[model samples]
Target: MSHQPDERQLSLNAFLHDTGHHEASWRHPESGAERIGDIAWFQDIARKVEAAKLDAVFLADGPAWWGTGHRPSNNFEPITLLTALATVTERIGLISTASTTFYEPFNLARLFASLDRISGGRAGWNIVTTFSEDAAYNFGLDGVPSHEERYARAQDFIDVVTKLWDSWEDDALVVDRESGDYVDTSKVHAIDHVGPYLKVRGPFSAPRTPQGRPVYVQAGSSNEGRAFAARNAEAIFTAHQTIEDARAFYDDIKSKARALGRNPDHVKVRPGISPFIADTTAEAEELSQYFNRLTVPAYGLTQLEKMAGTSLRHLELDERVPVEVFGGAGNVLDNNRSRRQVVANIVERDRPTLRELLHRLAGGRGHNVVAGTPVQVADTIQEWFEGGAADGFNVMPPLYPQLLDAFTGQVVPILQDRGLFRTEYAGTTLREHYGLPRPDSQYADEPALAVGT
Candidate 1:
């Protein structure tokens, strides 16, 4: 048997949150959360990621506000924001999360395809079934849909959207000035899609995008979520606090994809990692502690309340959390179901006091949090890549330009020196960065079919 090629050429993406990855990043003096309403700030971040030869810059979004006024909220819409970023950046992939449960397939397809075209084929769509009741309310619904139902709808939604994207052939447009023919009508086919959640008729208004359909990404880690990723996602964003968990998830998703008759290498698994790098290990640890100290206890309690699906108002900050609050073994918490489970699992396994739990979650939920020197940080990334745990990582720097600068200036060079990452961009588009193929239109054979059949 032939030996498998090395998978050490890891792909890295910058997971851009409002201010930074640390929950208290906005409170830090160096962060730029004050410019939350400015598009230029986001564009600057995108340019930085591109300069570093990163595969993509991802924007996490929710349809409605889940956190109270105590924490930084998602202020800008992702599609529009990414579109603006695309105009300035030449190489970085721009990915934005949009909820299948709350959006029409036709509109989403149009928006993402437009971005891909504008960016010359560097757009990606992160598919999610919105989990918040607030999001449901905003969408004119009384409550959020059941988990199984949401996945079912998502499957259908993706089918319709992709079909629409493929409705027009690449050469559908024929600009013949003498003949006064702007487009070849015969080449354009109508996708009369009628599904359980959507009914869209005819060809897409926009032409085929640069990469055909934007790279499909998924971030859920549940059973249904894993199945969905195996079937559809080219890239996956996961949250795991430990190497053991990351490796398990990586193996499980790839194995599932293989069983489904897909090349497992086609699916890239990346876990969220927030690195707080400093000149020295002690300095990094101090910085981590500083952020931890700045965390608002009231906000943490409120977040826990949401995660636990039960109120923690009566409990003191120093009190030990009872497993019974998580509804014991038989209890089901469905508020933010996945997050609730993550927090519950941590509480049950570690049995930390309420204060300790808050500290652990201060750095953007359960994403791996590390504070160290540049070399140590690079070592962590290398170990994870070489050990079959991740493709690369979703870099979530704890602060703004400072943290981002440290990673790019300090850690990136180390990665390049080890022959793990590129010093300069290899291609012009996000597809080039990720080594993904540009998709062919399903309607490319219209004229041939019309004549033969």
Candidate 2:
């Protein structure tokens, strides 16, 4: 083990969407909606992030169609797209979302291992337990499983995947040509994992990857989600509309991680922030409103219905959203089931009109939305970064390429000037860049498990 003097650097990841996080961004003049199918455009965007020296670039994925007719919902499978991105960019870490509810542990392990090998160790997995009933139908299930059942399966899934990732020791591959022995067989071990939801027996075919395993990332913030992340996740992508809420969530995750006998610092909490940037705060607000105006009322209402888990068609779009309309998010103490709590908080705090609420959420889907100048945006980031509210941010630009460029070109320089973010790449692998130590294989000393004899 090695130690170094503490100097905290903010980690930023570019969350790529078709055009941007804004629901109507495709209608923006600066948007490259036509280039959504062009691989080179994505490659170019990835290059821009790499050049800015951000920590990583992330892609979100889902098996089911988004069921929305208004926005550009087309997407490439994150792994496939990121592989192409890996070829064009060198320093930026490539993270992809894959669901435990749908993927087998062994196959998922192999895919990410290959990605790690191909990218020279820059790979991260955003683990998700899919709860979409539409997604369940795709897999032949009548409906989504209970949350507890899905989480239990997720735990077993991660255990099997990690064991597979660790089955082959780092030094197992020894090319002794004269001896005609390509590997040291004694170093390889089988992980026989048996669980209520998953069972796997394996001496993984591939050798240990550069970082031991892809960085474990979790994306939910429900009570169960918090516990799972404490026990497993290295990084957490969360959603909170206020700094107070963000701080509360941050404290809870760290305390829980510490209580579980893990280093609190190891679990990085990053809330999503979608910024609308301009030369001045007023101009930035106008830009944000411009995107909001382009939104179709029908689409926003549909989205609201999904989040609230109830039909809101009876309400007028121009009127203030009733507090009681949020009947399905389980109230304030209902365990934070969905984005209902976020929406509830927004209504309770600001009393935004239905249209205004839609526009607010249209930017980042319960994530914080800020419209400001470069310095102001940088200030918000610095405030959260240093105020025990966040370790970093998931930079969700409302418009792709243009807004991303604005962030990288305008805000990033300010952050760098203030000594909050990196001005250059300091490491090659994602683990190194994120300040995490490379992990040793799980079979460093123990013999292979022999089971079901």
The prediction achieving the highest lDDT against the true structure is 2
Give the poorly placed runs of model 1, Cα more than 4 Å off. 1-8, 324-336, 446-453
**lDDT (Cα atoms) of all candidates against the true structure:** 0.83, 0.88
Cα lDDT of model 2 by residue, 34-67, tens digit: 9998898889999999999998898888899988
Across residues 1-453, which tens digit of lDDT does each residue of candidate 1 receive? Answer: 112234447789988887887778899886797897788888888888888888999998998876577777887899999999988988889999999999988889889988998999889999999878998989899998899899989999998898889887888778999999987778777877788877877578867887878999999887788899999999999887767767888999999999999888879899888999998999999999999999989888877787787887787778888877876421121223556666766777788889888988888687888899999999999888888999879999888777988998899988888878887777877767776677788778755223212
Cα-based TM-score, every candidate: 0.92, 0.96
Task: Give per-candidate clash totals.
Answer: 0, 0
- For model 1 the local lDDT of residue 276 reads 92
Which regions of candidate 2 deviate over 4 angstroms?
Answer: 1-6, 327-334, 449-453
Local distance difference test, candidate 1: 0.83
